[model samples]
Target: MTISRWKPNVTVAAVIEQNGKFLLIEEHTAQGLRLNTPAGHLDPGESPIEGCVRETLEETAHAFTPTALIGIYMARSSHRTGNKEDVTYMRFAFAGELGAREAGRALDEGIVRTVWMTADEIRASVSRHRSPLLLQCIEDYLAGKRYPLDLIHVDESVR
Candidate 1:
């Protein structure tokens, strides 16, 4: 007899700001068109904060400096690649500042475009969000949500 193994994917979220506007992406989702912050799976050997900054820069063409971790989210969903494979994700959402955009940098694949939207505009687009947490993250950010950078402690042994 044989058994299968499962692993929960680790992901990072970036809540980027510029002149009071939040950076977001419009993407295609199983639920329909939806908006989301620049986010993606964490690469091996990279800390959550590093992953967040990398993803934000890749998707938005702007540098990101995560100041606080707003919240962590977990969800199970089917793969969109027609395999319909079940997958679970551990997402680290962070609030941060957006630095200058890089010239000649292209947005990551699957991202349509990066746009700046106010909290109210984000609220109005609830129906278009890739996930329910899209609006929730924004609301939390607007609510002054914050957690110390030290909140996430990575044991040096893991490095």
Candidate 2:
């Protein structure tokens, strides 16, 4: 008998805040237009921190330097009410600084535009978020929760 291996999709996100507002992107999703942090899957041969930087640039057209790890989160996303097609995502959340946008850089394909929203605005629009973890990360950031980036290490094999 053969047993299939189950693995969660690993992703990285940037939690960038400035002047009491958080950076976010409005993007097209299968469910419709949705909001999310600058985030994406961890690509082959890249660490979570590197993936976070790359995703931020792709989504927001800005350079991001992650300084600390916020928290790791896992969420099960379902297309509908059924559990059969649910996908579990393990996200490595990081707090970072966003540099000025690159001139004339196109946003990621599905990204409509960038928006800075307050915590209350984000809380009120939970229905429009790509995943529930978005708010959790934001709230955690607001609460001053953080860890050193050294908590995660990438081996030379993946470098």
Candidate 3:
């Protein structure tokens, strides 16, 4: 039998903050309603930064300009109640500026609404988080950890 390589799903997230509140999205998960950062998978042919910007707009109805890399995280889930297989995700989280909302724009499927929460509020609701990374990203952002956006280089062939 041939050994198959394990591949982790790549995702991007935006840690948008203003006036001490961080922006988060409430969405329907197989487990039920959950909160997460404005995040999603990286699309084919797009860089992580580009994917982060796109996902932020799609999930929160606001434009996002990623300024710095917040952190890279890897997490694994073992047979979640409704999931048939174990899964791992590699996330590139960024800190960014969130712009004005797009008029009448609809959020991505499964997204119910966007809410701004203080760090205390987030800490209080850990049980409702979609993933631990949701709060870890925020904590990393609050601790003033950031890497230059140029840290990631996409090959010209991908353009």
Candidate 4:
């Protein structure tokens, strides 16, 4: 018998804040209404922080300046994309400031709108979150979890 090794997919999330409210994207999913931070898969050639910044801008049409990393989260589940299978995700979350909103960039497909909500409001809407990490990241940020931007270092040759 052979045991197959499991590989968890990596994702990066951004938590942008303004005046004590968080920026969340409302997106339509097969499961109905869902809310999530500006986040997505870590594309090739981008570090977690860079990916977070990119995802935020893509999903929110706003510039994001990641000040600190929150924490990492891991989740596992089963779903059928066309066939039933187990899936896992490792998420890197960051808390930071949002720069000015761009004029012409469109929000990513499936994104309904962006909203600002307090942490308490987020906690109340837990059932509508796309993933548990949504609230976890917010809570962690509120708990004062912050890491220096210099923590992520990539060589210039990698660019």
Candidate 5:
């Protein structure tokens, strides 16, 4: 019997807060319309921080500068159908500043719109969230948990 190595899919997310609300993306998914933070998979040759910044821009049409690492999260999903396999995602979530939106830029594919919601509002819409991490990241941010950006080390070789 041959053993297969398990590798979790690595992703990055931006936990952007303005006023008393957090930024979230509304997109179409197999499970239907769902809300998530500005997030996506890490791309080749990009640091996690860079990936988070890029994803935030692509999904929300706003520039993001990550200042602090909110938290790292891991979750498993068996609901994905096409691949017929269980998958785990390792997410690096960052707290950041959101800059001006690019004029007339369309959001990423499948993204219907961007919305801001208060923590209490988010808590009330748990059933509409794409993943539980969306809320976990926000709660962590609310609790004042943050790590310096220096905590992540990207090797020069990756560039």
Candidate 6:
């Protein structure tokens, strides 16, 4: 008998909407070019909120201050380059203020560009989305779904 430990890949995403548009990244993925919100895997020694801020900056070259959590979601995907194992992702989605892009800062590697799209445009282009959660998060934001930032408590030990 073998004991197994299962852990989902925890990640954070920033749902940055401003002036009737939502900020998204057009990046190259295993599935080819795809659009996604500013999102990435949470790093060690950082809380989910901090991870969101970092990911938003890295992907969009902009500062973000998360105000509310949109939701937490889990999904299984099989997109590894050469692996057949399905990976489960646990994502914490946040909505907040997106600052101006940093001058002379380069977008993260694999990110082609940053673009703003209206909800209608996003809905129409679901086929190009990197993940199903991308549109879900945006729609949730538009639907006024927001949870207090304190909803998830990160112990000091985790930070």
Listed per model in order, the count of residue pairs whose N, CA or C atoms clash below 3 Å is: 1, 0, 0, 0, 0, 0
Candidate 3 lDDT, 39-147, residue by residue in tens: 9999999999999999999999999999999899999866567558688999999998989899999999999999999999999999999988998999999999999
lDDT of 5 by residue, 1-159 (tens): 999999999999999999999999999998899999999999999999999999999999999999999999999977855767688999999998999999998999999999999999999999999878999999999999999999999999999
TM-score, cand. 5 vs. native: 0.96
Task: Kindly list the per-residue Cα lDDT of model 6 for residues 1-159, writing each as its tens digit.
Answer: 999999999999999888899999999988899999999999999999999999999999999999999999988888668777688999999999998789999999999999999999999999999888998899899999999999999888985
Task: Judge candidate 2 against the unseen true structure and give its global Cα lDDT, from 0 to 1.
Answer: 0.95
Tens-place lDDT per residue, model 4, 36-146, is 999999988888888998999999999998888898899886766567867798999998888999999999999999999999899999989988889999999988999
TM-score against truth, every candidate: 0.86, 0.95, 0.95, 0.89, 0.96, 0.95
Give Cα-based local distance difference scores for all models. 0.84, 0.95, 0.94, 0.89, 0.95, 0.93
Distance (Å) between predicted and true CA of 53, model 5?
A: 0.6
Model 3: lowest-lDDT 10 consecutive positions: 77-86
Give a tens-digit lDDT track for model 2, residues 1-159.
Answer: 999998999999999999999999999987889999999999999999999999999999999999999999999987863344779999999998999889999999999999999999999999999988999999999999999999998999997
lDDT of 1 by residue, 1-159 (tens): 898788888989998766778889987766666699889899977889999999999988888999999998888766466566677878899998888889999988777888889888888888777766677777788888899989998777666
| C-alpha lDDT of residue 102 in model 2 | 95
How large an RMSD does model 3 have?
1.3
Model with the higher TM-score, candidate 1 or 5:
5
lDDT of 5 at 142: 98
Whole-model lDDT for model 1 versus the true structure?
Answer: 0.84
The 10-residue segment with the lowest total lDDT in model 5: 77-86
Model 4 segments more than 4 A misplaced: 1-4, 80-82, 155-159
How many backbone overlaps does candidate 5 show? 0
